[model samples]
Target: MTDADAQTAPDADVTQLEELSVTANRVDGPQAAVGSAISSISGEELEQRQIRVVSDVLRELPGVAVNRTGPAGAATAVRIRGSEANQTLVIVDGIRVNDPGTSGEFDFANLLNLEVERVDVLRGPQSALYGSDAIGGVINIVTRKGEPGPPRFRASIEGGSFKTMTGTASVSGGTEAYDFLFAGQGFSTRGVSTASRFDAVVPTRSLDHDGYKSGTGLAKVSVRPTEALEFTGVARYTEFDADRDGFGATSDGYPFAAAVDNRDTEKGKQFFGRAQAKATLLGGAWDHILGLSYTNQDRRSFAGTDLKTYASLGEMTRFDYQTNVRFETQGALPASHVLTFGADHTRDAVKSFTAFPFPADAPNPLRKHIDNAALVGQYQIGFFEKLFVTGSVRRDFNDRFEEATTYRFASAYTFDQTKTKIRGSWGTGVKNPTTFELFGFSGNYVPNSDLKPERGEGWDVGVDQPIWDDRIVIDATYFQQRVRDLISSETVPDPGDPTGFVNRPINLAGTSKIDGVELGLTLKPINGLTLRSAYTFTDGQDATGATLVRRPTHIASFNANYAFLDDRANVNLGVIYNGRQRDLAYDAATFARTSVPLKAYTLISLAASYKLHQNAEIYGRVENLFDKNYEEVLTYNTPGRTAYGGLKVSF
Candidate 1:
């Protein structure tokens, strides 16, 4: 009786995924109506996996790569679709957190998961909507907002290997006219050495452990006097301290590749705040948002235990305005059109100096500032409930660089019979040089004020298919990109001394090209059992036909989740494999760089949780289950076989 039914069953491998909303751009709509490469990670999933760090969640995505130079609270980077780390833009509650004083890249370290409701990721060039620094993609973190309910409190504490301890507490409530939320978190860890024994010329020398500590606080409030109008304000602050080791002479040896023990320390503080007013008018046909955001980062580096002097600071202020209008045709089969307009203004200021009694000293430092303004517009239309299309354009005016224009086009079509969706997109992006790159820094390097902005363009096409009556789903996409005007350093004639050369920044005439394929599959074979997998193949090359550094040719991941014990107990298993890649190594003796091959490796994790009461739960997880010894960075040591247990209570 079962054999005949199984053979005739509809093989539709799918669930309803396109019903989600896409918030990675100024224009918001259902995912099925948008033609970009996008994905969403929900808060429930993050809670189940206990992934406290955002970059850990990004590593398993189809086309994203995350790597840290050392352990927790260290310098971390997220790269997408073979683009450089600095090319990806990150936003936290409508505030841009990228560093303006340095390389203009956002470091993912110390970004704990607090009150995050969802994460939306858009992959591809998006300068048409976001302006500069979006050549790769965008990451938007949406936090939880207060709803109409009674006051609630949540708190948890956990300690594990490496002398690591973390705790968080939050309180939230809301009424018809007012809502408020407050939260705080703290973390500290005694980490492994950043400079490993494998990298040392003197293998017998023992290294000292470098540690890190961080604290954060957040507050949010909203006032809704009317159903159609609301005002919201958010403010968050974080402070962190990191101990480190470097390459230099030590007590036991000379010219050491990795220092055994050093008293170097780095301290940083960051603040992000935003205020906005939202209104819906014109009989529910128009929507508008007006907002202002500010970001500040302060950092100091000390060479000795006494903490003597080198400091830098960066601050950014931004203003935004947007409007959206919708029109619908009256008919049995209704058609719709939407139009969006937006504007952005930003200012940046930075200053750096050394007061440690050296040539780098600048008691009265040189402060630099710059301003930029941009205007953008978008149009979208859908017909027959099956076909959708969009067009976007942006113009940017910079204080230093030339005026830049960017645009994007996309289309999507869904089949009514089988529910298969086909989508494609094309876009261009630009990145202006940072303040440090233009008129800052001193000593062995010279700043170039004539450098032009980097420019890039890319495209992608994808298909979503279902099989076994929506039980299994598969999606695949192919993407390609080209970038030019990369900045590099070159030797120039020394102006102070004869028979010597100095380094100066210049724009290279060559271009970089990247092409890749991303494939994903999800299967729900039985109740409480779900399986998902992803694989990516990337090929990146320079204009001289050389492979790009730190880009793996192959990457894959698999995860399994199941709930047993009447859905009160849950377990999850995850496996990730990274292929071999090339990295540059510098010789301490000659100060020359050479390419070195890094070996491939795999990591596995296991987690389980049980509910004791409706408002109480206990959970634990083991990371690096096999204790695999592998290095993501050339000489940095990653953790091995760590375990943690915690309890959660809410009322």
Candidate 2:
């Protein structure tokens, strides 16, 4: 049997509900005793929303923002609670894909949407469960696996304004002992004409040449030799290319740099396999999950230039192998007291290359290696019929960095026979500076070897209640966080340089703080109508009373769907609103405005779907219904109204 079949089969002896989870060691409910805030999105919603990239789907959540340089396959990054991009962790099937050498974070432009089965966003501090790169949160992408019997296939094609075109296909098949799945996606866009919104004029020399292209593929296979043992393997690859203008101060300001290739491209491959066994002893049973995951990445980047646009290319390569062994007690102390233990190890080899347009022997590249090891333990206990608590700790040691320890504590209380629940959790998070931040070339930029691990602490308190005969669910939560030893560049006068400039990392200000409240509601008033809404209010600042840049203070969203003509067809509509934010200045004379106050705009989207057959459905959507004009940045513009329609067939 495949993983999906195995998941559906539960032991008749167990009395607990089959819990599905990715953030915790134990698969359980969200309200279960744990130290993190986890959220999930299903494949159906992914298809309904027509989300082509991971960042687009994540932006629907509270306190999260995505910034794209331009177009679909351009450089993209995410910000959470005012934290930098690299502060968040991106994982695929328990395998880490973060580059150890660059502060550049993972861009979803390279992912194939057809292969994604589910997404889990685990928020808050996760250093105890994962290691570095978990200060802000963790995003886990789980791909589709096996098909039941005969070969299954699906294909979709869509086109819209700005010459955008997208296509995706997937095929799967299997027998009783083995199964396989493969999927691929390709997309291209002409991009928005920046000249239309700027103060420059040209005949076909438009800044709109910022087009993009990307491709992705995924494959998975699983085999089972016996009822008690099974094996699974998965691999995926992606590449993206973009042509954009350089990051110059102004469109006509001295032409600081020319547009070299301006290609932001990356390729990554991952393979992971797992073996599991089951047995029974002493009226209790043991289920083992042992696995190994390896991943590799290659990245190339360039900056636009003065005449014909020179290129500055940077490349990073990483190799990781980890073994995870987990054991849990089946009937420990009446199923109320459960314990879990696991160990992990990883080794990484890194190399970085940079080429300038004018220099042939500027500086040699750098090579380094990193290794990490950790051991963790967690315990969950139910003190009484209405009270529960969980605690966990982990010690991590890295070869190139100092050792550190992280921990978490959480508690939950049930009142009125579990009709109402209150939970709170506190944890610590840590992150190591990427290799580029520590060992890059030193001309105008300098690397700091004295840097220490950035640390953070936070807690979340929430209440969940069911009302109106369980037809309505309401949840409210408040969170707060504080981080220390933040790294930033400090400029000083250069004695021998012509323009006099030198930059180095400094542990500026002692602490940065963020606090917010999130409210969520789910209501099913009639039989066929459902409504969901969420709102988040956030405040972020440092000891100096200056607001952290790029973090908006208010975000709100609502979605409503009503089934028409018998539950076989339906229409869904949604609206999202984001408030303005303050922009920070990197230099003295370059402050273009007192504030980059983004205008508030509402995006309206409509989706309609009808089932053509028992296993086939066709859907269409009109996004940005009003063609609203907006900007997430100072000069960059977002896409206008667009329409798409597709069909989905599952068997």
Candidate 3:
């Protein structure tokens, strides 16, 4: 797979090619060459949406759901195939960005969309390529690299409701020896007020006005002194401030409103840098890449009042450094045999501080550092030009706990000169406990250092085919995952007060399972118009046979885009529907009452963009076109009938 393949795949099944290219380990080609259910969103699509955050970009993907718990740069989580937020691995430029301090999960709200080039979503169980935290698969964000051409520059500014303002600028230039690119963006908005839903004890409304301000920048430079020696480096930095209000109470008990106002100001910064060098060894037969990267993130929230009981002034910091060296040999045994071997080393450290009440007068902090080293190898073999098999294994050693090993096996077969393909893979994954889950400000909770990593095993099988002169492509896949030794906080009775309680993180008694099916279609009725659709059906249950909360069983999305006016203008219409999900658990003690029901809802959006010149364009979008009010999260409502417009220019 090469740049040529990405730019000129067969038009008959372009959609399938997009999916295949993304799902198959960054490989660029058509569906017949890839083995999993994957989805890719282009940069053009992002601009058409006029989306400011990653959450907005992901809304177009089926089976993927995002909950904006608060304002921009606040707390946000994404669910894939009914998996918990922590079960997914978010990779930026091939480096894991999940903060170890915050349950090894990065808040999606803090992500800006300006620097993204494309996004690839692997549907399920991707531990084979990545490692832990990939139990539910991967969402890989690939940033832009400087194009090989003359110097180019662009800038734009836009304004909208709530007194929002945004500005972006970028410059790129590359020659044979070196290439450099830089981009930056700033965003600000006067956010909505906070309110508690179905709550009586707390005020229904609060005067707190929540808002956010954020800035992000990216830089990349590649140096190629010789044909056999190349060095590439990239860096990204983002910082933001967010305001949050208070909590609420309901008859059922204490209910935290999904959205709230805050006197507290949350501030955080993320920095990442990487350098990789590829060299030819063993007389050109052996190609190797040595890469090193370091990432750091810090977040702190300062409250205006003494929130010792209900809230806490919190601070968290995390650092991770990784080095990977892999050597590959093509035609090892035959023209179609390839083998790769690598060693991975990672160091992770986290520190968390929280202010508490009473006996704990001052802020308490917990700190931990872990070192892990692994040996990994993978092999691919093609048979008779139509069949392929791949296998991989890895053994990991950790200084803080036990050692674990995992493996994966997959096979692929193609027909019709590779116009149709079928493939399957099975693998394992693990997740380490976060600092907060282990140790935090003391209250009705206890720390458990003995908690083991949550383990998962799963497999995916899928088929990709072309129909009707290859103008229509269809892909269907099914996946299943079983996770054991799941860690969760459970409420136990308080000895002092019968009705009171304590919450503690404990390993569950048995395994939880997630099974689902995904169907995708791409039809080109005529030139200049394309219709793409996808549907996902998921069934998630624990050993106790209980439905997973915050997960919907059915999710679907579709889009139609037409390029007309001599290819100078475009129109896009999209629909997204989410099925009912099991609601919040009102009473954790009983665990007997059924879950509340979240209603099903659908949303429609329209976008139109006109090119004013070769390098400039104007775009607008009407979201929630019908003003249909819905909730990505229970109680916390999403915006209604919002309209946004923007401008773009490129040199």
Using lDDT as the measure, what is the rank order of every candidate, best first?
1, 3, 2
What's the CA error at residue 340 for candidate 3, in Å? 1.1
Higher-ranked by lDDT: 2 or 3: 3
Clashes of 1: 11
**Candidate 3: where is the Cα deviation over 4 Å?**
1-15, 18-33, 197-208, 250-262, 281-285, 305-335, 357-363, 441-446, 493-500, 586-594
Predicted candidate 1: what Cα RMSD to the true structure?
6.7
Q: Global lDDT of each model?
A: 0.77, 0.62, 0.68
Model 2 Cα lDDT, one tens digit per residue, 1-651: 012211222211000112333544333323444434555665656766667777777766655666665556655777665566777777764456665545635666566576676766666777776767777777776777777799988777777767778888888999888888988888888876432232222223344456777777777877877655557666666666665543323335422221222322333332333333333233343344555555556554444322322212223222222222323335534336656566667665555665531123434566655567877777776644456677878788877778899987877776766568787888888887666676654335656767777888888888877788767878777899788877766766654555655666766568888899877777889998878787778898865667776677887888887887787898888888877777533333231224346666788898888988877888888888999887655455567888877776766
Compute the lDDT of residue 33 as modeled in candidate 1.
Answer: 70
lDDT measured at residue 234 in model 1 versus the true structure, 0 to 100: 87
Enumerate clash totals for all models, in the order shown.
Answer: 11, 5, 4
Which candidate comes out best when scored by lDDT? 1
Per-residue error at 300 for model 1, in Å?
1.0
Determine which window of 10 residues in candidate 3 has minimal summed lDDT. 1-10
Root-mean-square deviation of every model: 6.7, 5.2, 4.6
Evaluate model 3: give its TM-score.
0.88
